[model samples]
Structure formats: structure tokens, C-alpha cells
Target: MQREGRRDSWEEEIKENSSAVERVLKLVEEDAVVLFSKSGCCISVAAKALLSTLGAHPTVHQLDKEKEGEEMEGALLTMLAAPPAVPAVFIGGKLVGGMEQLMSCHITGSLLPLLKEAGALWF
Candidate 1:
């Protein structure tokens, strides 16, 4: 019975993980900009603030606070061609990467064009 219980629990976990992965996939394509972040992460805060300051109001998802955040994060890592790290930025249904990449785009003056292309910016 004990062994069976563990197996059952494992199966349940797998189901939940699958659901989380599906959710993550949907979320990334949900808006012109989607930020998969953690509330406690300063980098996440910075990324959001920067985007907001640039006049782009992105759809923010604090994965760490969600019931399936860990699973989603795990799925993100697997889904992306790069390593998983929060806050993950998705723009125009493309993985734009983390805070550094975002800032680089901003600094290089490419971010606005990308935003415009994605329909997240008009001005």
C-alpha cells in the first residue's frame, strides 16, 4: 500500500506538471508582451518598471506566487532554446529573454521597434 501511495502521488505530480506546461505555453502567446516573473525578484521588478517607463504595459505573471509557478518555470526552461531564468520576457510571441536582454534592447534602441512591430507600441 505504501509503495502504491508513492506511485499515485508521482502520477498526480506528473499530471499537474503537464497542466502547468500547457498553461505556460498559452500564457506566452496571450498578449503583445508577457513577463513571467517572481514578485520577490528585483530583476523582475526592474524589467517591469523599465517596460512601463517605456510606455508598454505588459501582461505580468508572477509565477512564483502561482499554484503552478514552479512547474511552469520548469516547462519554460524546457520550451525555450535558452536556460530558464526569471523574469522571462516574451514579446510578440517570441522569447525576448531576461532582464539583461531587455535592457540591452532598450539601450540599443531596438526595443521600441520590436514593440512597435509587435503592436505593443504606437508612439
Candidate 2:
């Protein structure tokens, strides 16, 4: 976590307005649910599976496989201001966070509403 007023690595990255960040911003709007994850990450896979089961059919972008993945990863680091981990999930063109946040919404019965509002689900 970043200190209250101290600067961090992501500060500069976010300022540069890199193409990767631009791409991510575009992707989030293109789909109701966008998941930025790694193929080898089990939690990412599980999150994807869970959304699939819920009929969300989220758009997935794997950082480990793309040509611009490294750049995107850096962008994700800044986008996820909290813990800054993988499996960044965006819903309705909004950042809904990682697996834990997703599960929290699901467990709390709010996931369905989000999905429906995002047009990723009908029921």
C-alpha cells in the first residue's frame, strides 16, 4: 500500500498516459464485464468460471499472453489503487475489483443486480 503522501511507481506511469491504459479504458467500455487476469492465476480462472456460471460471459484479457501485457500490467497496478494485484475485474465500464470483491458482491446478492444492470445477464 502507498503511504499517505509519499509518491509511488504508479504515479509516473499513470501520468504518462500510456497506450496500455488507453487500451484498458477502451476495453472496459466495450463489454459489460471485463476481467484483466493472468492465465496461470487460479483465482483469476475461478473468478472467470464463477461469472460464466452466473451467465455474465465477461470479456477476459490475459496479461501473461498479450503483446502489450507488460504495459497493461503497469496500468493495472495504478488502476487498482488498493492492494494492487491481478484479476482486475470491471463491470458496466466500472472497476468492481478482484475476486474477493466479486465474491463479496455475489455472496451479498448484489452481483446479480450489477450483472443485470450492465446487460450481462437477463435474470
Give me the candidate number with maximum TM-score. 2
Report, for all candidates in order, the number of backbone clashes: 0, 0
TM-score, cand. 1: 0.77
Regions more than 4 Å wrong, model 2: 1-11
lDDT of 1 by residue, 1-123 (tens): 986886666566556678876797688778999999877888888899998888888999988788888888876665443464688888998888888889999999999998999999778
TM-scores for all predictions: 0.77, 0.86
**Candidate 1 residue pairs that clash:** none
lDDT on C-alpha atoms for all candidate structures:
0.82, 0.86
lDDT score for residue 31 of model 1:
94
